[model samples]
Target: MRKERILYIYPTLSSFIKGDAEILSREYEVTHFRVHPTSWHSLLRSLISQLFHLIFNLRKYDIVYIWFADYHSFLPTLFCKRFKKRCYIVAGGYDVCREKKYGYGSFTNPIRGFMTARSIKNCTTVIAVSKNIKQIIRHVFPSTNCVTIYNGVVLKPGKEDVEKESLVLTVSMASTAKNVFIKGIDRIIEVADLMQETKFILIGTERQLLEKIGYKIPDNLQVLGFVDHSHLQEIYSKSKVYCQLSRRESFCLALAEAMLYNCNPVITNIGGMPEVTGKNGFIINEYSAQNCSFVIKKALEAKTNSLGRERILSEFTIETRAEKILNLLESN
Candidate 1:
């Protein structure tokens, strides 16, 4: 039997995007197209290249699978609609959000917002990473076809013999100043300052960036640049608690990964954090440092168990996502 051909398009090759591609590849012929637009010039160049690519290659694929509904997705969805091809767009938080304060989200910009909304409307289906995101999409575009598909993670078994320490951890890409605020790095620093006894480890951002933003690094907090998966797993094994105090998050893969390692989660009640945390860990309704510090203390003191690991295994495994997404694409 001949497998259907799928054209996979994404702005960046994130782990979740790569996971979806791998899933689709098991049952379909998949081709990857990266459209990273870091600047205005790059955006124009990417669009031109994509236009040409689709113009010449659109007919070969049975479906167009896009990661996010942003400028990169506008052309693919538009082309798919014109050619009567099935197009599925996975909507992460940024696409449907309108965070004006930090200038986050595609909707923060007028032109980007229009293109993103149109892309969602034109696509055959929009896959929201969380129920919160699905609600946002329906609220903004009432008639758009949308469904919730939680982002999946590969379960990493935590070593039972590994001694977990009094360490607090968070993973985020905080290269830019806006990202520092959006990912709640500021909050982490504040909490770290308040809780001087507990050690805080922040991965995926550099100490230089924090210093550049005029943030004084506390003695107990260790800021690290991005580390490989093996190193991250090692960090997860030793950490007692994982914290995600983001202003916005779609599915929070890091939180899930930490839970898989049996790290107690202390997250804000924002976007998908609460959904991901469920009853497995602590949730902080207030974003203040005092409040988050209090929550982290409680999480650190809580007994370690396999409940977090069990939740990920049952609900957010890669196998579950593969089954659901494959069925959706094949049926529609």
Candidate 2:
């Protein structure tokens, strides 16, 4: 049997999408198209160019796989109507959400919201990253065929010999300035101030901005600006507990990565975090500093186990995700 050709489209060459593209390429002949934009002018230009490109070349591929239902997906989704092409959209967090508090999310903008709705409504399938997201999609695009496929990661389990330190770790991108508060960096700082004995490491690029926003850097809290992946893995291994006290999350990839290194999770009970942590880690029912502190303390006393890593290996590997995707493609 001949392998099918797939045109994989994404807003940018983001790490997670790049990982998925690589996995998809293993089984299918994949051509990648990136509609990345740095400014409003560029966004419009890129969308126009991608639309023309898709319109002219739509027949070359057997399927079109698009990531996110924002501006980038709009054109291809529009052309799919005339061409009658089978296109699948993988909904990342922001594109599928209406996180008004942060003043972000595709659905927050009227134009983008319209584009997102049309794209999702027309796509052959909608791949929601979590069960929570699937529910959101069903409510918003009731007639659309949406399915839950938990995001997967490349697991590089840390060696058992690395002695776990008395450190608590939380990682963020820091580029989303508002997300510092949304992802509970503010609460992390508060908890650090109270738990003066324990060391808390917050990794991200916006440390300066976070401090500028009047978050007093406590003595026990160490805000290490951006670290490379290897360094992050080392920190993940050394940390006793990984905290993800977010207001909402589609799937907390950081928490999952930390689990791969055998760090016990202390995540908030929001979105798919509970699904990711499962019964292996502590889930905070409340988002108060007191509740987070209590959970961290309890997580510290609990012995580290392979349950987290084992759970990910069985269910959330990139290979597993690829297999599911392939099954979907072939079945259709």
Candidate 3:
């Protein structure tokens, strides 16, 4: 039997997006399309390109799968509706949010909000990365079809002989001042300052970005920018705790990745984080540095075991996500 052909569209090729493409490829002929736009000129060019591409080639694919509902998603969803094709959009965090404080989320801008809302409503189904995101979508567009599918991770074998250290880690793609607060880098820095004895490693952001925010970095907190997957796994294996003190997060993949290495999580009670942490880790209700520091101490003293890894294995494995995604796509 011939497999269905799927057109996968995304703004950026993140790991999670790539994972979904790989999953669909097992049962479908997948074609990847990137619609990343950096400037106004590029945005215009991208829109023209997407319109022409779909106009000519959309009928070649049986289904259209998009990673996020944004400007890039607008044309695809609109075209799918016109052509009477099945279109599924994965709503990760920002697409469903309107966090005005930090100027984050798709709805923060009026034009972008309009496009995002239309894309979400017109799409055949919205695949929410968390129940929190699904609730947000249902609240805004009550009649839109939505489903909760937690993002999954591939489980890595634990190094039983390897010993964890007194290191706390966090990963965020924060570069500006607003993102510092949004991703809670400021809070992490404060906690690192307070607990001078413990070492904190922050991956995915530059030290200069933090410095520009008028904050002094403590010797204990190491800002290693971005590390490759192998190095990240090595760090995860050695770290004792993983922290995410974000003001807003839809679903944090880093926290899950850390937990897979048996790194006990210390995260804020925001978005899908508490849902991800469950009873396997610690949750901080307050965002203050003193409060976060206190929670970190508790996480540091907690017993070390495979509970974190076990939770991920049972609930958020790639195989489980693949099965669920295929079922959703194949069913009515």
lDDT of 2: 0.85
Error of 1 at 206 (Å): 1.2
**Clashes found in each candidate (C-alpha, N, C closer than 3 A):** 0, 0, 1
Top candidate, metric lDDT: 1
Model 3: per-residue lDDT, tens digit, 217-289?
Answer: 9999999998898899999999999999999998898999898888889998899987787898988887788
* Candidate 1 lDDT for residue 135: 91
lDDT of each: 0.91, 0.85, 0.90
Best-fitting candidate, scored by TM-score: 1
Give the residue spans of candidate 1 off by over 4 A.
Answer: none
Give the per-residue lDDT of model 1 (tens digit) for 66-181.
Answer: 99999999999999999999999999898888888889999899999999988999999999999999999899899999999999996567786688999999999878999899
Candidates, ranked, TM-score: 1, 3, 2
lDDT of 2 by residue, 104-184 (tens): 688889998999999998889999989888999999889999988878877577897678988899987656567787677
